[model samples]
Target: MELSVVTGCLAGAISQDPEDVIQGGDVLNKQASASMEGFLQANAPPETEVLGGPCEESSWIRPPVDFLKCNWDASIDGRSKKMGMGLVFRDSSGGFRAAAISNIPYITDPEIAESIAARWVVSMCAKLGFQSVVFERDALVVVNSLLSPSPCWRICGGIVEDTRRMLHQFNSWTVKHARRSANQVAYFLAKHALSLVQDIVWRGECPSFL
Candidate 1:
């Protein structure tokens, strides 16, 4: 589907409550804030943890010599109904090639949020004229959905199909699941995006914070 059509579908899917739609943005904001706390609590990391430099003894694996590894993740801000997406690209030698952080409308469902992130990954990579890329995400549902041949009937099915189409445009690509710890860079970037006013893309370097 075209970008405009896909965007329209996404918007329609996100605005499911007629009451919220009629009540105005205030009601939507209240609803988002009420649910967001639970969502974040459910997804929070363990209290005891080792903090180290990026990729230090991390499970994040490198791709083949000629392939680029792209780690992608998404975070949500319920009050604003915004989703932050992050992607970090690295070569086989673990050298950062590029990174991106974007803020977009939040999809309440975690699976949908992940599916959107995957779609964004492929779309951005295609636009950058990349090939032989390896995609890593912490969301196994999304990885399984993408790797499955059977038609997806989930709410995010259309977005998943769009992602598959974009992936086919690449000379080669693979999607796999990674532990959250292994995807810390992308995860942090995603959280940071929640505070960003505009999307940021860095080529040939990574954000100083990372």
Candidate 2:
């Protein structure tokens, strides 16, 4: 499929306000929503911790042979109500395959921002024709929502559902949560995107800053 078609699908999926959009296929009861909300509140890592300074103890891990790992992160600016998303794709040997950074309007909620980032990365991977991929991100809530069999009912529910649908296009895929330290490349890329007026993409080359 064309990249424009993928992007158009994403735009339609998330165009409505969260309260106004509930996917028919992934609908959950209010009780389920309440229970899940509490769990998210209790277990989700703090924003600062997820976006904190680098750590020497944790590092990026390579995927299995024949697979690609995509590490993704998001940076949000409260004043601008915009979010920057970064995605770095690496091969099983840990060689950089591609990277991209994008800036877009965002909801104030961090979970929503991360959800949008996940959707964007998935769409990008689909556009790149990646069949076997592992997605890693620093937002535990967003990761959990993707991994859950039940539909997410948070404000980012629609975005999460969209991401999940896109993931089905892959032959093999998994979504995992990683430490900020393990996601440094994408983290910094997201920060770098905050200064840009347009998206940037690198293929078969590393960014100079890295």
lDDT of 2 by residue, 1-210 (tens): 000001111221122222132222222223323432442354231221122221222678888798898988887766656666778899998898888777776554666677777888988898778878888877676677777779788878998888777777777777777777798878766755554544556677564445
| lDDT of all predictions | 0.64, 0.64
Candidates in order, TM-scores: namely: 0.71, 0.71
Q: Return the lDDT, model 2, position 158.
A: 90
Q: What stretches of model 2 exceed 4 Å from their correct place?
A: 1-57
